[model samples]
Target: MTVQPNIQGQAQANPVSEIWYTRCPVPTTSGIAQHFRWIHQEFERHGIKVESIRAAADQAVRNSHYSHTQPASFREGGNVPPIWTRANGQDTVVVGITWVDEEQLILVRPDSDIKTLADLKGRRFGVPKHDTKIVDIARGQDLRGLLTALDLAGLTPADVEFVNVAGGEFDLREQGERREGRRHGVVEALLAGTVDVIYAKGAVSAALVVKHGLHPIIDINANPDPFVRVNAGTPRPITVNRDLAVERPDIVARYLAILLKTAAWAKENPTAVVKAIAAETSSTEEIVRKGYGPELHLHFDVKLTEQYIAALRKQKDYLLEWGFLKEDFDFDGWILPGPLELARALAADDAIKITL
Candidate 1:
């Protein structure tokens, strides 16, 4: 994507055609905007085509959802892949962050003797090892959750034996394919008596608990301390390739404006938000409500607030400490606030225009 020279006769860049976007199956403002078809409609009015990187036919193109290699693309999801990409020299800027805490649970079989976090001592903890070339997000998230749980009980990694359970690929498949491939290795290991404890989250995990009659030994979300609930998805970042943010900042701001509008719409429409999240996650509304809570809609607002920035910093440090990152970079320098500021202005003007 490129732009032409102005009236002053500056050098021209290549013409734009299409832009790419990808979001995880979670409650994100971008996902809500995509759910309502606002993102495509807004970009279409400007003669730009929008494509989903996850839906791309080529495996390499689809892998860009995790690698952030595709130029002029946007990604809103778990913090692991993006953090990994940034540390490994991917030039992307975090435009915004949304902190929507979901159900982070430590699970055991219903008939198991593990009833509390202290009971997890000496138990076999299941940690998924994804067979992917990119960053292993599942392992990072699972390990963080398990470590946090253990810390609460005054235990450490040495207190339990961690079992490496083989996990699926990192590719984000279609909704039907994702549903069909929902058999998690950790869950399988738990049920097969190979692991005594495992970590789970989101609506699908909630559904699995009901289906398998699994018992949750610890509810991380129920903890009053926000730090205790910090995981891969707590402070999700919305990122864009540097080329997009630097060369075509207008497009970046416009896209973020749509997300802002969607966030506002979500705040006043809890029922609709729940339905959209259910569709985005490929789960039932009941499960979405159960996993994310009824007020999940109110938490979709994206911002560059200090609170989320600190959370992201914590997550990044955790990843680096766990060896998920090659090296650490300037965390503060990776965030660009210009696009989000412009987006808020554009959204406010649009709101005023509608009012007028």
Candidate 2:
């Protein structure tokens, strides 16, 4: 299905006064840019106000982080929500993709008999059913991870029982008060024997496994096949609303240029990058390093590479096949590479000037 651009009822102004941006609590170039205040500073230099959708008071505005319904907004996060939003006809275009392999683990109790993916056959696998109006990103991520692990073990979903563990609302707020005890429902379920196995990812999950003595049946990130690691946030995309991309290409390109600069900065300062990522993910530096590896900084480069695109397409297809997407859309047509190209040229020019 071709997704028609929906610009009606959008802001008609050429240069938007303010732009909204959001990113997942993961390792992302945009997250690094936000950590150093570079994004805000760059936009302010252009006489534009930058707002964070995650910090919005109104729930409807914060929901834009998942729905992509807000105009003149940018998001760099998991592939699930963006794919769901685009398939549902939200006018958004993919500007860039970043591939960061985090720990995608099929976890079981430390004392559980399940020692490998093959042992998961006929066992209860926990999949969190998030109480959200939009797509269930956690659910999608877990299912994909489980499916991949099963495929590696020469098993299928039909071989196991999927137990729906109830999850709380999707709160994007950074404050600990609002999110306290909210993210551990699935873990609680696992410990209570509600499920025999569960899929988890990233630093937080690593910390949880250590804290609760959970055993990892398989870590997909350690797999040699890149396709095996293709889940929600593995090949995350940077997307901008169609109005923002079309009406003000300069803004989109400039934002991406800052991200490019941030990626470059990350490579040279691994310690600082780890600290920033820890802060971004609400995780400790030790856990972040343990989950993403010591050489995580080297993987921060963002580009429109074919390998990343193919991985993202793999994720999109998974979402569609599982009914997470409302309708199938042209995946290649959804990408707008012009802005990223401009961003690359701008970054290259800045590099030359720095040397001169």
Candidate 3:
């Protein structure tokens, strides 16, 4: 699984076309995406006009974090302009994976006596519900976390009551309407005593636990397996369109370079990152900073270590076994290294670090 991004000869390109870089709601990527204007200005040197598309607030819930667009929408006979995407480990759109250490927290009411994984035996587990055609990768990932923790307790899914709480988007909110976002769904359920335990991801989820003084029973960060790591954390990647990587490899490389550089900046300037995230998310810097607890590291590293690849394989197997994916594809071929390799070579010597 350790993929050393191979340095290759640059491919020539025709007149550069517009670049639509889409982003998801994950904290680090969302914060970075909000600052993409600077990234686009840099892209101008390559004769490419890069446009950052912040998917609709609800778009991630619908596309499973991948932005939806007509095939070849960004290029002539090229793959869609989804330079980054999120699909279940079962989906075939994966091109590369960036191992980010964001963790999901499974919390219980403060009054609950569920102090250990074994205590969850008969407790109600709350999973968020979304009304979208896109695959619910978050739900599946949370379930995997639950399953993993249960296994440690010598239990299984059948030992607990699984409930889909109301939290995702609805049709009424599609037309510039207001509705409750899924961020508060689990906490609401817990507060109302509807579920004994709930799984949450990101800063908002982190806040819910702290504000309510809930008990965190399982932190996905403690899991050593890659499958659970990705499910409970942010080991996913910033995927790109295959056609873009093939046709305009330079643009792909440059784009990735900018992202890698930004990631480095985030690591060195936590306060600035927090401020930027607050402004981008319209939340207080205090809340954003709290979400970025001491355990959260914002740096980006693109190493496909053997452990990572094996974990991905196991994830694929689990997804297939659970009927989340109907067919399997060549996982090895889906990985594109040229862009990452080129990005490393083009980046400033001190701007980014690559560790295998």
Candidate that would win on TM-score:
1
In candidate 3 the C-alpha lDDT for residue 209 amounts to: 62
Cα lDDT of model 2 by residue, 51-126, tens digit: 9999999989999999898888999988999999999998899999998888888889999999877798899988
Any idea what lDDT model 1 has? 0.84
Cα-based lDDT for every prediction: 0.84, 0.83, 0.56
Prediction RMSDs, each to the true structure: 3.4, 5.0, 6.4
lDDT of 3 by residue, 15-86 (tens): 455666544334544345335465556756556666444443544333322444522112110011121122
Q: lDDT by residue for model 1 over 9-117, one digit each (tens)? A: 2212535678999999887888888887788888887788999988889989989888999878999999999999999999999999988889988999999999888
Model 2 scores a C-alpha lDDT of: 0.83
Candidate 1 has which clashing residue pairs, if any?
none
**Candidate 3 wrong stretches, greater than 4 Å:** 1-13, 33-36, 55-95, 167-181, 224-227, 279-283, 295-298, 348-356
- Arranged by lDDT, best first: 1, 2, 3
Clashing pairs in 2: none
TM-score of 2: 0.92
